[model samples]
Target: MQKKSIQNKDSLKRFVDKGINEKELSPFDPPDAYNPLNIETIPYEKMHPFLKELIDEHKNFAEVLSKFETALMNWKNNNWIFNDEIDIGLKQFFNFFDEKVPLHNQKEEKKLFPLLHKKLIEIGEHNSVDSSITGINLMEDEHLKVAQAVAIVFNFLELGSQLPDKRSREITFELAYEQGMAIIETMKLHIFREENILFPQAMKLLSKEKLDDFN
Candidate 1:
C-alpha cells in the first residue's frame, strides 16, 4: 500500500511538471485532420497560407505587446521617460489596435457566425448548428469586453493634450499603457479560443463545396 501511494504521488508530480492537465492539452489539439494549422499535430510547413497568415499576425502583435510592456516597465522602474513623439506613437498604436481590429471581429460575428450556423444545419446536424450559434455568441460577448476596455484607453490617451509637464505625461503614459496591456491580454486569449476551438469546429462543419462559393 505504501509503495502504491508513493508511485501515485510521483505520477501526479510528473503530470504537473509536464503540464499534462486535460484543460491545457485539450485546447492545443485540433478538432479533425482537415485543419492544417493544428499545432499539436501539424508542422508549420504544412499550414495553408490563410491559416499561416492568421497565426503570423497573432504572433506579431504579441511581440509588439511584449516590447511595449517592457518599455512601460523600464519607465516605471528607472524613470527613463519618453518624448512627445513617442507618446503620440503609443497613442496611435493603441487606437488602431483597439478600434480597427475589433471591426474585423465584428464582421465575423455579424456575418460569418450566422452563415456558419446555417451551413451546419444544412449539413443535417441540428446539434452542430445550435452549438455554433451558442459558441459564436459567447465569443462576440468577449470581444465586446475587450473593445469597451480599449475605448477607455483611447479616451485616457486623448487627455494627454491637457498634460502640463513631463511628469504628467509619464503618469498618463503609464495608465494608457496598462489599460492597453490588459486589453491585449484579453485579445490574445480571444484569438487562442477562436483559432483552437471555434475555427476547427467550423472547418469540420463547412465543406469545401460550401466554402467555395464564399471564397
Candidate 2:
C-alpha cells in the first residue's frame, strides 16, 4: 500500500509538471459545458437584504481577485521572481479566502441553499435522473472546487519558495500560477451564476416569508 501511494504521488507530480511545461493550463473557457441560465440579474438595490449583503461581499472579493491576478502576472513576467508586492497580494488573497469565504458559503449552504433546493424541486428545475441535482448542487460543487484550488495554489507557492533548486521552484510556481488563474475564473463565474441565476430563482420561487427568514 505504501509503495502504491508513493507511485500515486509520483504520477501526480509528473502530471502537474507536464501540465505546466507542455501546454497552457490557465485559460478556463469551457465550450458550452456550462450554459448560464437565461435569467436576468436582479438589480442590487432591489435584492433581498441577505442577497444584497452577499453581493457586497462579492464586490470586495472581486477587488482582491483583481489584485491577485496582477501580482501573479508580475511574478510570471519576472521569471518567477518573488517580490514584496507579490507577497502582499498573495497574503491579501489568502487572508480574504480564509476569513470570508467560509462564512459566506455557510450562509448559502446552510441558510439559503437548502430552501432553494426544495423550491427548485417543486418547480421541476432539478435533473430528471436525480432530484438532488439542482442549481444549488452545482453552486455547492463549485464552492468545494474553489476551496481546493486555493489550497493547491497556496501550497505550491509556499513549496516553490522553499525549494532548493531553481528548476523545481519554477515548476511549482508555474503550477501555482495555473491553479491561481483557475481560482479567479471559477470564482467570477460562480458569482455570476449566483447573482443572475440562483439568487434570482430564489427570489422568484421562494415566498416573501421564506426570503425574510434569511434576515
Candidate 3:
C-alpha cells in the first residue's frame, strides 16, 4: 500500500509540473493560423474577384477602425497621456477613408451598382412594374449619408489634433469618441448592407460574363 501510494504521488507531481510548464509558456507566442485577434467577419466563399476585393478592402478598413478605437480607449484610460497617439491613429483612419475608401466606393458606384442594377432590373427584382425602388438607390443614399457621418468624425479628429491643453484635449477626445462611435455604427451597417444585400444580389442576378467584366 505504501509503495502504491508513493507511485501515485509521483505521477500526480509530474502532472502538476506539466501543467505549470504549459501555463508558463507565453500565450502570445502563437502560430500565424491561431489568429489571436479573433477577426470575425462574414464568410464570403467563392465570390467574384472584384467583389472579393471590395470585401477585403472593407475588412481592412474595419481593422484600422478597430485600431483607432483602441487608441481612443488607451488615451482615455491613461488620463489622456497619449493624446498625440490618438491623433496619429485618427489620421490613419481618416487617410484610409480619404485615400482608399472613396475609390473603393466609387468602383461600386460607377461599375458595380450600374451593372448590378441593370441585371436586377432585367430579372425584375428591382425597378419592377410594381416596385420602382431599387437596391442601388438605397445603397447610394447610404453611401452619401455614411460619407457625411464619416466626414464629421474626421473633422472632429482633425480639430482635436490642434488641442492646446489637457482640458481641451479631454473635452475634444470625449466629443470625438461619441462622434467616432456614431460613425462606426453607421458605417458598419452600411458595410453589412452592401456585403449581405447588394453584393449577394449582384452575384445571384448577374451572369458569368458580367461578373467577368467587373473582374
Candidate 4:
C-alpha cells in the first residue's frame, strides 16, 4: 500500500511539472482545470466556493494596494524626480485605485451589505447587522478619504510634469509620501475590518439560501 502511494505521489508531481522545472513554472500555470460551472444548476453546497472566489479577488486588491504603497515609499525616500514612463505608470495606478476600486465598494455597500444584513436579521441576530453596519459605514468613509489622497498624488504628478517649478523636489516628494501613507493606512484598516469582522460574520450569518441568492 505504501509503495502504491509513493507511485501515486510521483505521478502527481510529474503531472504538475509536465516538463518544466518547478522553479520555471509561473504562478498562473497549471491553470485551474477548467470545470466551467454549470451556473444554472449550481446547488447551495457549491455557494461557498463562489463566495471564496469573490473574497480572493478582494484580497488581490489589497496586494495591489500594498505594491503601490511600496513604490510610493521608494519614490519619497529618494527624490521626487521620475522618468516620464514611471510617471505615467504611477498615474495609471492612481486612476485604477481611485476610479475602479470605488465601483467595487459600491457593489459591497449596495448589494452585498444589504443582503448580508437581511440574512442576519432573519436569523434573529440583530447584533451582527449592527456591527456590519458600523464597519460598512466606516469603510465607506475611509474609501472617500483615500480617494481624495489619490487625487492629491495625481495633481502633484500632473503639475510636476508640466511646470517642474512650483515646488522643490523635496517638497514634492514629501507630499507624495504623506498622501501615499494616508492611502495605505486607510486601506490597511479597511481590509483588516473586512477580513477580521465583516466577512466571517457574514459567512456565519448567511444561510444556504442567502448564499445561493448572492451567487
Candidate 5:
C-alpha cells in the first residue's frame, strides 16, 4: 500500500510537471482545487478555505496597487515619460479592476456578506455591526462607490493613449495616479474592517447548518 501511494504521488507530480513545464499549460488548475461551495459537502471542522481565498485576493489587490504606484513613480521620474512599458503596467492595473475586482466583490456580496449578516442576526448582535460602515447594505454601497472610482481611473488611463499632446498624457497619468491611490486606500480600510471585525464575529457565530447551506 505504501509503495502504491508513493507511485501515485510520483505519477501525479510528473503529470503536474508536464502540464506546467510544457508550453501547453494554458488552462491549468491546481491540484488541491478550492471551490468555496465544496465546504458545504465536507465536514466543517476547518472551514477556513473560502475565507482565506477572500483575504488572499485582498492581499493580491494590495500587490497590484503597489505595482501601479511604482509604475507611476517610474513615469514621473522619467520626465513625464510615457512608454509602452508604462502603458502595459497601467493597463494591467485597469484590468485588475475590470476582471478581478468584480469577481472578488461577487464572492463577498453573494456569499460572505450574507453569511456574516445571518450570523450576526442569529447571535442577536445585528445591532452591533455598524450600519454605516460594515453592514451588508453599507458595504455594498461602498462597493458601488469604489466601482465608480475605478471607472474614472480606467477611463483616464484608457484615454491617455488617444490624447494628442505629451502634456495632456502626463496630466491624465497624474490624475490616474491620485485616483488609484485614493481608491486603494479606501479599499484597505474596508478590508481591515472585514478581516478584523466582521470575519471573526462570523466565524464565532456561524453554524454548521449555515455552512452546509453555503454549499
Candidate 6:
C-alpha cells in the first residue's frame, strides 16, 4: 500500500510538472451563459438592505481571494517555499471561508432561497419537469462544490507539508493550487450569478413584505 501510494504521488508530480492540458482545465472555465440576468445596474443605496449586506460580504471575499491568488502564485514561483506574507494570505483565505462562508450561505439558504424557490415556481420560471430544478438549485449546488474544493485544497496542502519527499510535497501542493483556483473561480461566478440573476429575480418576484423579512 505504501509503495503504491508513493508511486501514485510520483506520477501526479510528473503530470503537474508537465502542466495540465487545456482540455482538463476547461471544466473549471466559466460557461458561456454566465452573464448577469439583469441589464440595469442597481445602485447600492437602492438595493435591499439584505442584498447590500450580502454584496458587502462578497466584496470583502473578493479582496481576500485576490490576495490568496497572489500568495499561491508566489508560493508556486518560489518552489513551494512558505513565507510570512504567503502564510498570512493562506490563513486569511481559510479563516474567511471557515468563519464567513457558512453563515453567508445560511442567510441565503435559510432566509432567501426558500422564498425565492416558491416565487420562481409561482411565476413559472422553474423547470417544468422538476419543480426542484431552478436557479436556486444551481446556486445551492455550487455552494456544495465550493465547500468541497476548499476541503480538497486544505487537505492536500496539509498532507503535502508533512510529506518527507520533495516530489510528494510538490505534487500535493500543485494539486492544492489547482483546487484553490477552482475555489476562486467558482466563487466569482457564484457571486456573479447571485448578484445578477438570483438577487434581481428575488427583488422582482418577491413582494416588498417578503423581501423585508430578509432584513
**Residues 1-215, model 3: lDDT tens digits:** 11122112221111101133343311111122122121233358767888899999999988988877777677668765656777688778878888998898889988889877677557554432334445576667767866776777566666776878768877776776766665565565557657766676677777768878876
Q: Using TM-score as the measure, what is the rank order of every candidate, best first?
A: 2, 6, 3, 5, 4, 1
Query: How many residue pairs clash per model?
Result: 0, 0, 0, 0, 0, 0
Per-residue lDDT of 57-123 in model 1, one digit per residue for the tens? 6676666566555655554565635565455546555755766566556556664567665664464
Candidate 2 lDDT at 21 equals 40
lDDT of 3 at 151: 76
lDDT of each: 0.53, 0.75, 0.63, 0.54, 0.60, 0.74
Evaluated at residue 183, the lDDT of candidate 2 is 76
How do the residues 21-74 of candidate 4 rate in per-residue lDDT, one tens digit apiece?
A: 334421112232111111122333443654565566677777777667667766
Any idea what lDDT model 6 has?
0.74
* Predicted model with the maximum lDDT: 2
Better of 2 and 4 by lDDT: 2
Better of 2 and 6 by TM-score: 2
List pairs with backbone clashes in candidate 5. none
The residue ranges of model 5 lying beyond 4 angstroms of the native Cα positions read 1-47, 121-134, 165-169
Across residues 1-215, which tens digit of lDDT does each residue of candidate 5 receive? 11122112221111112223444220111232221111223223444666667778888988887777777777777865678877777778888888999999998888778767665455443323232222455467668878997888778877976898989898887787777766766566566545655555556667656645554
Model 2: lDDT to the true structure:
0.75
User: What lDDT score goes with residue 176 in model 1?
Assistant: 68
Q: Any runs in candidate 4 off by more than 4 Å, and if so which?
A: 1-47, 84-89, 117-133, 163-169
Error of model 2, residue 187, in angstroms? 0.3
State residue 65's C-alpha deviation in candidate 1, in Å.
3.2
Cα distance off (Å), candidate 4, residue 41: 30
Off by over 4 Å in 6: 1-31, 37-41
